[model samples]
Target: MGKPVLIIISGHPATGKTTFGKMISEELKIPLVSPDGIKEILWDNIGWKHDFTEWSNVGKVSFELMYYFIETCLAQGKSLVAEAHFHPEINNARLNALKDKYGCKLLQVHCKADKSVIEERFRQRMASDNFHPGHRHGIVEVYGEEKFYDKLGKGEKLLNIDGEVYEVDTTNAENIDSNKVLEFIKSNL
Candidate 1:
């Protein structure tokens, strides 16, 4: 068996991080750790208010759970893909510490898209009934559309970790080079 690998998929909202991460995880047969998935579970069981502070707190807990799961997998010498809107200032140190402790190979796939596309996608997501209520209420309803759009327009803040970085332009989902992405992951691992 080879060394364990951590494939981190990160980007701003509506950048297709989750979609790309899911593809990678499926193709590579790696377990996926997603904070949003955890947050949805929490919202389902514990309940949530349509308030920013409440949503933020739930998000924090989701991150904690994601870290715990990642560490557990690493401890067992397992490779996995983790997807999140990772803040550099907050997550870089934590990820570095995990890498050091587990001696795992790290790789990051940073997804990016045009700002206008992101705004449109985000709006579509917000309006879609299929999406989790937490996102619709917590993000736009609580934070307001202008503030949320402003945040999205600021672009992604990627984690500062020593790793091979693959940037994917997701402006047009149909245009993403899945074969190239798979090749990058295969080469790294």
Candidate 2:
């Protein structure tokens, strides 16, 4: 089988990673695998009684399920787009290892947005029913708004990747140009 393409759309919360992933998935016509989406499903299926305190455990399971999905896709010679707020130190290494194991072409899309814009978007999401429980009920519930903002203010430090990277700035949400990102992925593929 030919090597598959694995596109990673990653960034801090509210940076529009999911939106980018969706656009890329549609353009590439491949599955979109989201750890947060998987976590939501796990929360709904496993119940949220331990969500706040056991979120790490829940996240671990969700990541496991995500990799399972990736492995299945690789075995089928199917490409995929995965969206997440990946930890630079850890998840990047894992992704690299997976690329080696599956011989898949890896393209990383790093997303960023203005802090104030991200915070506003985050607040709006928290007020909405669509807010991820893992964020609203887990992280925010434990850290509170003030602390959450403090950490977010420090900002996310992205790790370096070996291959091509496309940076997308979504500060002006109305002006996000997904075509650029798609073109980069298609060119890399």
Q: What are the TM-scores, per candidate, against the unseen true structure?
A: 0.95, 0.90
- Across 83-156, the per-residue lDDT of candidate 2 in tens digits comes to 87788887878888877887887889988988888888888888999775656777556556788876662456
In model 2, what are the clashing residue pairs, if there are any?
A: none
Candidate 1, 82-185: lDDT as tens digits: 99999998999999889999999889999888899989998898888888987777775777877778888474467789789999889988898889988999
lDDT agreement with native, every candidate: 0.88, 0.80
Residue clash pairs of candidate 1? none
The candidate scoring highest on TM-score is: 1
lDDT of 2 at 36: 85
With candidate 2 superimposed using the best TM-score fit, by how many Å does residue 139's alpha carbon deviate from the native? 3.3
**Shift in Å, residue 34, candidate 1:** 0.8
Poorest 10 consecutive residues of model 1 by lDDT?
Answer: 150-159
